[model samples]
Target: MRPPDNRRRRFEELYQANHDPVLGYVVRRTANGHDAADILAETFMTAWRRLDDVPAGEKARPWLFGVARRALANHHRGERRHTALTARLASELSAIQRQPREESADMDALAKAFEDLSDGYREVLSLADWEGMSIAEIAVVLGCSANAVRIRLHRARRRLARALSVDPPGRAARARVPEGDSA
Candidate 1:
């Protein structure tokens, strides 16, 4: 049998080779950078624990991806609980980091607009635009038809446009003008 050190070195070699793809899989499944990093760590930990199951050659990437997918799902479920706890303890940390104090007012307004959107619209935008998933991937994640996703995405864009326009000073004035009324 191979020595323990040899088995470990082999596992390290396989892990190093497949790390990037595994990380990309985690990133795609997660909501943000930090969550992706956590999932990636958990994926490697699983790999280390189950090194014997990892095939030595061509199948390694897929095996790692499968492990990553399961880890990501667990991470997502845990994240929901963590978010609820964190919201009570410290709200808006991520949002505050993304937006400076000067822009906080506009950000707050924009956030309200986003919140006003229907759940379907919000989820579609979050998965497709914010999380950057492909329509096909989003369909799988949301358990919806692809054409349905496309239609919802279109309506969501229109709704967002309307919301933004209504909040803009000039556009708000124009929208309020009566038909055939001169500016």
Candidate 2:
């Protein structure tokens, strides 16, 4: 294995090689150069910290893109959080009906069903389905054994299916998802 110094040099080389492309990637996705620059700096900093996790040679670009993608997602989530806070403050300051939009009844039911899931089930499902993370990646993120992730994912799906009435309640109860396995 190479020395840590050697690894640092390699990471520096990667930064030199990919910085422009990474910046371009962020710039195209972001609204302004300032946000792009922030994302660019964050992406490289993450790469620097996780140098060993970065794939070698041809795969590095895509890996860096993935990192940037996560950063962008986090950025958007923060924006949404701020927006939600403002909305909440506005709601507190006034009297509004806050009527639900004209969503389909089925959509409402699905949303309720998803909301009814336990936090653990919801998280695993979101990470797997919404975030498009692989089982191994989910395992890494959740800090659990891969088999445990698979088991929880399986259980979460079954519970969600039951909630949505896609799976029979009898089976959902009978299978009995182990409470011990949580992300």
Candidate 3:
């Protein structure tokens, strides 16, 4: 058997290798950086606890993603409230300062479009567009048939396109509109 220190070192190696992908997975599913961090921490915690169950080699990414999905679900369950995932994502994009102003504006508009999407549409878009998961993989993540994921993705894309086409509020309009106009 490997020494305890050797096993611990191996686990750290596996974790470090998978960290970025796992973080991306959490960020795509959650609304904000805070939630993403929470989910990521929970995912790694699960991994540490179930290290023996994680398969060796290339299959690790999928296994870790599965853990992330469970952690997100648990978060939602415990909170008993669901924030719009796209809204959270929008806030995250706004927090990134390195991008040019024009690029940030575009991202803000895209985030609004995403937020306007129906929950089904947002979920499909998050899985496919944000997470870069294949339709088959999204189907697995969502527990739906592949055809279902495809149909939802198609509709969601169309809706997002429509949402993006709408003009954003001007400064005057933003100031004048009642607080509940979009809400």
The order by descending lDDT is: 2, 3, 1
Q: In candidate 2, which residue ranges exceed 4 Å CA deviation?
A: 1-3, 94-183
Give the TM-score of each candidate: 0.43, 0.47, 0.42
What's the CA error at residue 183 for candidate 3, in Å?
A: 69
Across residues 1-183, which tens digit of lDDT does each residue of candidate 2 receive?
A: 655798889988999999999888898888889888989989999998899899999899999999999999998888899999999879964533344444455667777988999999899999999889999999999999999999999888888887877873356456555799754
| Local accuracy by lDDT, each model | 0.82, 0.86, 0.84
How do the candidates rank by TM-score, highest first? 2, 1, 3
lDDT against true structure, model 1: 0.82
The per-residue C-alpha lDDT of model 3 at residue 44 equals 86
Per-residue CA lDDT of model 3 for 1-183, tens digit only, reads 654996698689888899999999889878799999999998888888788898899998899999999999998776654456666767875677678899889889988889888888898999887799999999999999999998888778777776887433342356455786964
**Most TM-score-accurate candidate:** 2
Show how many residue pairs clash in every candidate, following the order shown.
0, 0, 1
**Cα displacement (Å) at residue 93, model 3:** 36
Candidate 1 local lDDT, 1-183, one digit each (tens): 655997789878987898888888777777799988988888888888888888879898898888888887787788789889888556567767677776887777778889999998999999988789999998998898999988888788778778867542234455466888977
Report the backbone clash tally of model 2: 0
Q: Candidate 3, residue 147: CA error in Å?
A: 57
